[model samples]
Structures are given as structure tokens and as C-alpha cells.
Target chain A: MTKRIQQFLNEQKPATPCVVIDLDVIKNNYGSMRTHLPLAQVFYAVKANPAPEVVNLLVNEGSSFDVASVPEVDLCLSQGANPDNISFGNTIKKEPHIAYAYSKGIRLFAFDSEEELLKISRAAPGSKVYCRILVENEGAQWPLSRKFGCEVEMAEDLLCQARELGLVPYGVSFHVGSQQTDLSQWDVAMTRVASLFMTLQERGIELTAINLGGGFPAHYIEHVEEMPAYADAVMRAIVGHFGNRLPKLMIEPGRSMVGDSGVLQAEVVLVSRKSNDDCKRWVYLDAGKFNGLAETLDEAITYRVTTSRDGEETEPVILAGPTCDSVDVIYEKKEYSLPLGLKAGDLVQFHSTGAYTTSYASVNFNGFEPIKAYCI
Target chain B: MTKRIQQFLNEQKPATPCVVIDLDVIKNNYGSMRTHLPLAQVFYAVKANPAPEVVNLLVNEGSSFDVASVPEVDLCLSQGANPDNISFGNTIKKEPHIAYAYSKGIRLFAFDSEEELLKISRAAPGSKVYCRILVENEGAQWPLSRKFGCEVEMAEDLLCQARELGLVPYGVSFHVGSQQTDLSQWDVAMTRVASLFMTLQERGIELTAINLGGGFPAHYIEHVEEMPAYADAVMRAIVGHFGNRLPKLMIEPGRSMVGDSGVLQAEVVLVSRKSNDDCKRWVYLDAGKFNGLAETLDEAITYRVTTSRDGEETEPVILAGPTCDSVDVIYEKKEYSLPLGLKAGDLVQFHSTGAYTTSYASVNFNGFEPIKAYCI
Candidate 1:
């Protein structure tokens, strides 16, 4: 925990199962991204953590936003973001919501399919639209299924058709995947995107932008390379593929912007063994998959844990949330060690959980209120 | 869809991505339980769907409650349920919450470990405590992990210790699993419980209640046995082992009590293929895994769907929820067919969603509101 978060926790002592976000950390992350990737314009992905405080801070930092819904557009604009700086980045949007966004003065949007493009044309006329082409999500810890993007050839046709539909075929976009580790995936993506640009140019549609959809990782159980390394690799990929004719670059950083900025403090609800001679321990926490840690569904995003009884003898334990549902078990197959002395009421801190945790909490599953987040 | 739900949808036209629950269906389901399992007292599990209307109706019907949290206890009480009819069924609970439940006049509790039992004794002294023994989850579609119940031998010792700790050694409970298809699993659980009862009787503690933890099936894609069939098997297992001296039987029904009562109405946001030549269509809906259809994770529960274009020629489609996250894909591996003419703005209804649908919705994962529930 940072001194700021530690001091806040000590002084306020908010109830267990709440997250404390350090604003200074988000500001610092923004600064690091800017310094490392100066060529790219930063579009903060609001779905990662749409806390007003985070948005306001990013707004002050002159950050553009990659919004997924109309509410996000309203949120960003309410916090003093220029509509020009907001991009409706979700490919799947309701036609009415697109109109609502357009009415609010948002001009940029993303679409993966021709049907969605038609909706955009009818709703947000002359809006700058980008086609998200499907790219390999190999080497990502949380690999994205082929849900968001489309084939490169189809994207080329979509852009050519965009002109006829009275929409600006701005550029192309692709996601390597969330928490992507291998830098070579970006190389492959950039190469494919460069070919698409060449193909589109031949079709008389000049694309001006390239949305490098969020694939940059946050600190997880695995050792993640810093922004500098990712920036270096991304810049190399762009420069190596595009040569002198560089397109306007946009990077939507969701997890990297705020993931490490918060710490989720949960209390141990129960600790037990199925049998007396059972070697493994079962540790149940107050917060669970429904409340916050939904990323732990497949044990995909393992948050580094620090307990109140740290430094005590540790042993592998199965972690679960305090719910009646059996699927609420956090980590059973993966080995996670906790202090042997850890018992009910012991505080457990999940680190680097600022991004996806709070936003994914259920309304009142099992009568537990959504996990609370306190931004400092 | 039921005529009531269909009529309510036509009249209300509330919005896309909402659950319309027919209270009469819940009443009928409750009535079915009473008709089939006349011997066992029904303890309606509130976590499945804690809609106040559902609770109030069950309360009026004299159904006892199985609450997992303090809020659930309060919800049941607020709905005119007697505290004596409520059971703190979750084995994993905080000590303070236990005290709160006790303060609110709750006495029954569930426990699997010594630590939890110790807490209950300190917090809610002299409570009617039951041991949850681990049982096979082999035949369950949604098999519960060992996060809940303990080893049968360990459960025996725990019940014996419950007496020593000043708490009433009430009974034993075991869950076959959620969405359980196999009836034989109940037989195995009962035989073990019968053996435990004999062991406890010899030890001079007279256990009364035998909690047949919920494993009842709700309507999904698979054919489910009628309530009478399940009730008969369960009663036979109890009578076959205990002979003339049947223990006080308690059945906790969550899913079966409420599952078939709801119809989730969602609009198709977009319909597209990855490529023009792609074999399957990708259909996006306003509701998804984070919203009403959480059981669709791993395609565990395949809901029967009715589209506005239902009569049109159908084709196998990849179904996904409307979210930026790739993990939001609802059913990819499972062969879910949709109307060939299905397009944006088409209404699709997912049936048998009254239980876990609205309860598991994320608060604001992608700036989209939680799936709304309206009980009529």
C-alpha cells in the first residue's frame, strides 16, 4: 500500500470490504503514459474505472476518453471533457443511444460490423468512425474471444462503404487483448493494419487515425513490463511498419491508467479445513466474485494479496467469497497461500485492483450491497 | 412466455434489458413444492431472487426462509415473515452479522467448521446449529465446490462439539449441487446422514431436523423431473434409512421456487458476421453475463429464448452481451440458434430467468445500468 492509502486507511478506518483509490497514483500513471508514448494521444477508457474523481483527474490531465456508453459520454462531458475528446468506443451500441451521444455533441465512434455502421450513419451523421478489425489475442493472460472485432478485408470494405453512407471512415482499430504480455502480437497487428491502410488508400478512402485498442497490461500475478517497455515496443511496431507516412495514433489505456491505483481491503469471514486431517485451508472473505473480484472467475487475474498477519507462516488455501452460491469460490484450482494464523476478521488487501473490481460488483446478490470504493 | 408476462411486456414496454416476473408463477411454484413434498417444510432461499414481491408472497404462503446475509433477514422480516421461520443458512458468516441476526430473533444457523461454530456460539448463543456435510456434486450442471460443506466424518465431530459448545446440536445438511439432474445423489447423501444420525444417537445427542439442502432443478434447456418425482425420491431416501423414526425434514428451495417465473426482455443491439462468408452470425443483446444471464458462464444454463422473429428460419449464432469486454460473450461453444431475420431493435425474451438473473447483475460494468427487475 502507498503511504497515502495506508494513511487514509489508518485515519479513517472505513469498514472492511471497501476500496481506497489513491488519486496521486492515477495522476502519476497518466504522467508515465504521456512521457513514454508521446507520439500517441491518450484516451482514458472509462469502463475500467468510471469514478468521477478518476475522470475529473484525467480531464485536468488533458486526457481524451474512450467511452463505451452514452452515460460515459455524459460522465466525461459533465467533468469538463470536450466532446471532441470523447470517442464512443463500443462497437455494439443501441441506435437510440447513438443518437443520445450525438445529441450530446460526441463525434467519434467505433464499429465492427456493417449493420452497426448503418445505425451510426442514421444516428450520428458524419461522425468520425473507425472499424475494429479482428487480430490474434495470443499471449494475453486474459485473452479476448473474437467478440469485438472483425476481419481485416471486411473492415476495408466497411470503410469504403462509410463514405457512401455519409460517415467519415476515420481509420482502423484492433485490440491485441487485455493484459497482453507478448510485444510481438502488436507487431503482427500493426503489420496487418498497415496492409489495410494501403488497401484502403488504393480504394480512394484516406484513413487518418489508428486506434491501438487497449491491450496494455496492469500489474497482475505475473510480472508486467512497465509503460516504457510497452511504449518502446508499440512505437517500434508503428515506425517499423508505417515508415515515414505515420497515421494519427490513439491509445485507449484502461487497466494501465488506474488498475494499480486502488487497494481492496476485505476481512476474512471464515477460515477452515473440510476435515481435521485436511492439509488445505478454506479462507472466506467478505468481498467476493459478485461484489468485486469478478476477474478471479477463472482465476485469470490474480491480485497480489497482503494480509494483516503477514510474515507469519503461510500455507496454500482456497479463497472464497461470503455467499451461499458455490460458484462464488475465488481461487480453488490455483494455489494461493495465506497466513496459517489468518482467521475471521483479519484484513486482507488485494493490490492493483483499481480498474475492473468496483465496476463489476453486483447490485445485491446474496443480500450483499455492491462493493464500495472510496477515492482519496 | 406466459400470457401474464407477455401481456405485461406489451402494456409496460418498460425498456430493453429488463426482467418481467409473474408473481403468480412464483405462487404456483411454491404451491407445487407444498403439493409434492407434503412431508418437508419448505425454506425458500432468498438469494436466488430477493425481489420483495417474491418474498412477501412466499411469506404469506407460510414458507420459511434460508437467508445468507443480515440484509436478507431484514428483507424477509420486512415482507411480514416471522423470525422463527428464518434460517441463517450460509455456513460462512461474519460474527457481528450472526449477532445482528440473533438480535433480530433468529436462532437457526449452519456451520461446517469449528471456528465458525465458535463465533456463532459467542455471537448467537444457544442457537439451533446444523452441520453441512460434503457430498458428491458429480451430476449437477452447476456443481458446487467444497467451499460450502465439510467432510461427513468431520461433520460428525462438529455436531458433537456443537453440543459441548452450548449450542443445540440440531441436525445435518448436504447439497447434491445446484441444477442437479441425477436423483441418485440424494440417496447417497441420505444414507450418510442416516449413519451420522445413528452415531450421534449412540453419543446421547438426539438430533431432530434433517436439512435436505437445495439441489432442485429449474427449467432450462434440459427436461426436469416434476416436483412430485423429486419429493418422492427424497422422502423415500429419508424413510428407507430412518424407517419408522423420521427426523424433522426441511427443504431449502431457491431456483425451483422462483426460476420459471421470469421472462427477461432484451433487444438485439446488433447482428453481424465476422466475415461475409462466415458461417455463424454474431448476435449482440442489451443484456449479458454481467447483467441477467450470469448462469450462461461456461454455458451452464441454456435458457429457452423466444424472439419477435421466432417463426422465421433460424440459424446457429454466436450470442454475446453488449459490452466492450470480450469475456462478455454469453454463448459461443453452445449451439444457440436465432432467427435468420433477427436484426437490431428486435426483442428477444429469455424464459425461466426469475431466480439468479437480476440478482447477479453488475451495478455499472460498462456504464450500462444493472438489468432491471419488475415483478407483476
Candidate 2:
């Protein structure tokens, strides 16, 4: 945790459980991602913790946004984001919502089926649409063959249908999955998407952008591989297939860009002994499954607990929350300790909780207030 | 599903994701609980579903409530529920919220420790307190021996301390965990609580109530044992321990009262084959881990889906939701069949989702609107 964060934690009233974003960390992350992927324009996936301040920071840093729904698109627009910079990345089935997006000048819409093509034709008329193709690859973290995309075989028909409707088939896109640690999966997807784009060009359809939808791994724990190598591989695959004529690459990175830049802090309310002789203990904090740290079952992502007090050595402690339900536990039997004298009134801070922590999670369980974010 | 419920589903506007509760079923469940424990006054745990309409129905039926938080207490009070009838069953350190409960004439509170007792003495002077005793029965269903309660030996000290502070020590309480099926284990808790009450009486502390904090099992699935016989055995043990002098018995039944009363109606968004033979067909619904169904991690409470169409023969299908996260799956490899023609936009309802279904959970994952209840 940063010194300014420690001082902020010390001064907080502790009346409400909240998520705090270190704008400096976000700036660093944005700067690093830009430097690494200089060729690819980054569209910050606002679905992961879409606070106005977070969105504003990403917008100020020259990052576009990938919005899945109207509310998310509206959120970005409300934060002073450029309409042309926003891509409605998810397949559109809701005709009215699609028409609204088109009216707002969002030309970069993703389509995966004839039904979506018809919906887009009827709703957006003459909109420049991106055909979302399924890139089936073995050994990838998550095969895109699951749902919500046109099969490699169906891509031609879908693109032809868009052309028949006079819709601009601007590009191809594919999302393998979220938290995809493997870089080989991007190479496989790029290879498949490149071929589809060439076939479309052969059919006399000119494209402008190829969107590699966001699924970049957001590592919370240390020692997880960084993404610069993966980004390089993806760039290589694009050049190998489409050569210098490869459309402008657009990568919408959600978790990676913001996951590690935020911290959620709550006061410890109770602590219990794991065993009579076991040194480890279970500490119950005010925050629970209701907020950002809800991926308890999927232990791939976890927050690192730190004390605001300086020079405090860490000990392993299982963190529980205040909800009455047993499943309300935030972390499963993990060890992370705080200050030796951490008491009821003392605050415990969790790092790397910015992404998908608060924007999508706020139910007000136990009458606890929603997370309040403080940027910078 | 009832005819009225089917009609309601047909009339509802097409929304991708929503939770619909049947008011008629809720009333039926509430009535059924009264029939099971005819002798004891029913205090419907308001934490189960604190919606004003839901609370009004339960209160109008002559059922009091057991509230765990100030907001819950305030909710009941707002619906005209008498404060004297409600008990603050949570056993933790009281905040300024305690003063509000006291001001509302909520005299009853639960206590588990010496530290909590001291705080309560200063915060809520002269309040009627219930000593939450921790029964040291290893075989006890949930031995809440962790966190909230005092040991059986500490009961003497607690009773003495309550008297010393001019607070009314009117009763004793014990919880055998939630959704516990072991009737024999519950008997052990009753026996221990009864014995502790006898010891307190011998020590000149006359109690007026013995609260067997409710853990009555509701067989959400088939072939599970009923709770009536268990409740009878527990009552018999109380009578056996104290003879005719047993205090006014109270039970904090949360799930049993509302667990079976509610069903969640979700729209099928998409259907696809999970296996080549279509033997593993997946019917994706709108409800996911964000809702309460995800709490049944070990199949403790299983929800069965039924279509609104008549003669809806069941076909085994895996259920998933629209969330991008892989873990958003609600039913994995679980077999359930819906109507043959049931496709996207068709309504499928899950049974036994009343109590902890919506009130105890939320759409914290996608930040969607909270579940709305219909009283039809």
C-alpha cells in the first residue's frame, strides 16, 4: 500500500465499507500498457469497476471503452468519454438498445449471427458492424466455442448477410475468456480472425479495425507472468497472417488495466481461533460477498491484506465477513496477517480490488452501505 | 407453480433477467409453519425477506419477527410491527444502532460474552437480555461454539452480571446451526440448554423464556426428514428437564418458514448442446451466482425448474446464466428438463427459493437491479 493510502486509511471515518483507487497506480498501469502495446489502441473495459472517476482517468489517459450494455455505454458517456471511441462489443439482440447505440454514433458494433445482423440492419441501418467469429483452439485457457459468437464456418454467411443489408463489415473480433493467462490462445484466435478477414476482403468487403476483445489476465498475486510477451505474440500473429495490411488492432483490456490499481478497506469486527494450538486465526471484517471480493469460490483472484500502521510484520489470518450466511465468507482458509494489535476498531486494507469489485457488485446486504471510491 | 403464478409470468414484460416471487405461495408457507409449531408463537425471521409487503403478510398472519440488525428492526417497525414482540437476536457488540432499538421499546436482546455484556450495560441500560449459551455438545449439529455465544459454564457468570447491571436476564438461547437435519443433535442442545436453565434457577435466577434458536430443517430436496417430530422431541426434552415449570419457549425459524414458499422465475436466454449427442444440452437462464441459488455449493438446497406451459415434461439439461464469468453457472451437470419448445424468452421457475433467496443475496456481480417481489 502507498504511504498516502495509509494516511488516508488512518483518517477515514470507517462508517462505510469502500473501495479506494490509487490513481497513481492506475496511471502507471495505463502508461505501462500504452508503452507495451503502442500499436494497439487500448479500450478500457468499463464493466470492471466502472466508477466515474476510474472511467474519467482512463479517458484522460487516451483509452477508449468497451461497453457490453446500454447502461455501461451511458456510464462512459456520462464520464465525458467520446462516443466514437466506445465500441458496443457484445452481440446485440435488443433492437431498441442497438438503435439507441447507433443514434449515439457508436458504429463499432459486434455481430455473431444472421439474427443479430437482421437486428442491426433494422435497428442501426448502415452501421459499421464487426463480425464476432469463434476461434476454436485446443489447450487454450478457455475455448471460445462456448457461446455468443459465430462459428468459423458461419462467419462467411454472417458477414455476407451484413453486406446484403449494406452494413459495413468493418472487422472481426473474438474473446477467449476472462483471466486468460496463456498467450498461445491469443495467437490461435488472431490466426483464425486473420483468415476470416482475408476471406471477407477477397469477397470485396473492406475492413478498418480488428478487435481482440478483452480477456487479459489481471494478476493479483505476485509471480504471475506479465503480459508484455503475450501482447508481442498477438502483434506477431496479426502481422504473420494479415501482413502490413492488418487492420488497426483494438484490444479491450478490462481486468489487467484496472484490477491491481484499487484497494478495498474495511474494519475488522471479530476474530476466532482456528484451533486451540493453531497460531492462525479467522478474522471477520465488515465487507463480505456483497462487494468486490466475492470471487471466494474461484480463488484465482484474492486481495492482499495490509495494515495502515507502518513497519508492521504480516501474519497469516483467514478473513471472514459480517454476513450471517455461511457462503458469505470472502476468502477461503487463506493466511494473511496484519498488525499484531489489530483490534475491533482497526482497519484492514485489501489491495488489487479495483476491477470488478464495486461497479457490478452492490446489494446492500445487512444494510451495509455501498462501496464509496476515492480516486488518487 | 400455481395457475395464478403462470398467468403472472405471461403478463410480465420481457426482461432479460429478473426474480419473481409468488405471494400466494409465501402465505401458504407461513400458514404451514404455524401448523407445524401450533403451541409456540411464530416469530418469522424478518431477515429472510424484509420487503414491506412480505412483512405485512407475515405480521397480518399473527407472526412476530426475529431481527438481527437495526435496519431489519426498523423495517418491521415501519410496517407497524410492535417492538416488544421483536427480539434483536444478533449477539455482537452493539453500536449506536442499539439506542434506536431501545428507543423503539425493543427490550429483548441476545448476549454471548462478558465483553458484550459490559458494552450492553452502558449502551442499553435495563434492557431485557437473553444469554446465548454455547452448548458443548460435540455432536451438536452446528456447535456455534465459535464467535457468538458463551460457554455453558459462563452462563452463571452472565446471569450474575446481568443482574448486577440492573438488566433483566429473562431467558437463555442456543442455535444448532442453519438447515441442520439431525434431530438427535438438536435434542442434545435442548438437553444442555434445559440443564443450564435448571442450574440458573437453582442459583436464584428466574428466567421467563428458553429460546431454542431455530435451525429447523426444510427438506428443500426430496427424501429429507421432516422437522416436526424433531421440534416435538426438543419440546419433550425441555419438559423433561424442567417439568411443568419450563419457560415460554421461543424459536428463531428463518428458512423453515420461508424456504419453500418462494420460487425464482427466470427467462431462458439461450440454449445449446454441451455434448455432441445433445445428451448434455445446456439451457442458459438469467439467474446465476449473483442470486441466492449459488449459496447451495454442496447441494444443500437444490432448485428444480418447471416451465409455465402445461404438461411440461422434464428433460435433463444443465443450467447457466448470462454472466461472462465461468463460475456464474447455477446448475452444473445437474439434470432438469423443461418444455420441448421452451427457447429463449420462455419463463422457467425454480421451486423453494423463498427465504434466503433474494433477501439474503443480491445482484452484486453485475450491479443489476435488486430482485422485486409480486404479491399475486
Predicted complex 2: DockQ:
0.26
Query: How does chain A of every candidate compare to the true chain A by TM-score?
Result: 0.99, 0.88
Identify the candidate with maximal TM-score: 1
- Native A-B interface contacts kept, per candidate: 0.98, 0.10
Q: Positional deviation of B133 in candidate 2, in angstroms? A: 6.4
Candidate number achieving the greatest lDDT relative to the actual structure: 1
Given candidate 2, what's the lDDT at residue A107? 78
lDDT of each: 0.92, 0.69
Docking class of 1: high
lDDT of 2 by residue, B65-94 (tens): 888677788888888898888988776434
Q: For candidate 2, write residues A141-201 as lDDT tens digits.
A: 3334355565665776677778889798788888867666666777788777777777777
lDDT of 1 by residue, B1-376 (tens): 7898989999889888999999999899888888888878999999999999999999999999999999999999999999999999999999999999999999999999999999999999999999999988988999988888888888888998999999999999989999888988889999889989988889898999999989898898899888888988898888899898988999999999999999999999999999989999999999999889999999999998889998889999999999898889888998988889999989999999998989899999999899989999
